[model samples]
Target: MSTRFSGKVAVVTGAAQGILRGVALGIAQEGGQVLLVDRAEFIHEVAAELPQGRGTGFIADLETYAGAHAAMARAMQLHGRIDLLINGVGGAIRMRPFAEFEAAQIDAEIRRSLMPTLYGCHAVLPHMLQQGRGTIVNVSSNATRGIRRVPYSAAKGGVNALTTALAMEYGEQGIRVVATAPGGTQAPPRRVPRNAEGDSAQEQAWMQEAVQQVTGSNFFKRYGTLEEQIAPILFIASDEASYITGAVLPVAGGDNG
Candidate 1:
């Protein structure tokens, strides 16, 4: 049997590493040509790891209009058409008290977490509309579920709202928009300490305990790996999920009610 995404073209933002890499690689494995977009210079390595001849990488700071436009343009230039997009760029900065969070921090959060997704969608929608079919999956966070950390929550909340609005507005054009809000994904690449000695065993134990505590609150009692989190993203982007749209699918271990 042929792969589900054979001959399709996908654009995955923040594809340099972590969950985004999983999503990109998953698409490639299914025979889709993937464009891996990221601001980090290491994106080339990530792209290379995808199925040979099935992936390419573009480096651009998607927080700016020019950057988002350039990345989209690059995908179009390479693939001639884009059928799927996974907007997986965004992260928390230094956590600060809600009351003490600076205006700059708020602005930065919006730019970092919301604008890139918005602009990428804007840049790609017209093309998808012309083709009369497309799927967009925005990466949100469990933070929106009252997880504290105000700025990050506010930004991801915007992403959730955007996904809903876009799904409704473009459903008539054969465009599907959805968001995935994952909670406490297993140790992110950038967060894990490099040297074992640098991270005390007690500290590591405390972190594991905290993760277990959080996971116990969810439906699933264990944290999800990057591959596991990528499953829903690929499903939503494929025709297999033809009837799904404007949905916020939470991938928390079990905490979501």
Candidate 2:
């Protein structure tokens, strides 16, 4: 693998599992010092799995601004500077049609999907501004155009807007903001389920519909692998994408959402 991240310090939120876990490991392999953040205690285990001294897992409820600020503060204390931040703390908690979603459920979905990225960006900007350069890679979803996840779609839409607006606002200050809109991805079962309650048959059927929509919308008619999604995110974070900012690259098999 390339040592594009040599001497860099990266902060990866949602590093306990899924795409974020892959990102943390990738950064370590590429010679970056990584601070992995998640509310899950398993985050420490993931950190320990990294090369010695290259990973430090931090547990923080990034859904809140205070937690986000604290996590970024810890990153600075541990590594002295943050060169990159990958916000990956989001997923569709409940997959069902828009009409079926209760007010509380819709609110929960937005909070789960959008708040972490918002708080993370708010907290990390001052540090990057002080250093005069940094990169932020947000994990968005192409489900922004799919069914049974209207709230999730809106939340990711917000993320895309945030990426573009931040890039425009801070590009001259040497910070690059970007995102990747991934399609359905095949990965190991979640160590922590997005929803602990049992899914009703109706819910399951709705979820299946959403899944079908995801794959069918893709030009390849298939879900992507973990690596496929991670590659573009790391590329945008690396100096290789120095001239790229304010862009949302679709890693969705040409879905372009």
RMSD versus native structure for model 2: 0.7
lDDT score for residue 98 of model 2: 97
Per TM-score, the best of the predicted structures is 2
Count of clashing residue pairs in every prediction: 4, 0
* Candidate 1 residue lDDT tens string, 108-192: 7788888999999998987898889999999998767543257778889999999999999999999999988888787565732
| Candidate 2: tens digits of C-alpha lDDT, residues 4-96 | 999999999999999989999999999999999999999999999999999999999988999999999999998889999999999999999
Q: What TM-score, to 2 decimals, does candidate 1 have? A: 0.88
Please list the residue runs of candidate 1 whose C-alpha ends up more than 4 Å from where it truly belongs after superposition.
191-216
Q: Global CA lDDT of candidate 1, please?
A: 0.82
The residue pairs in collision within model 2 are none
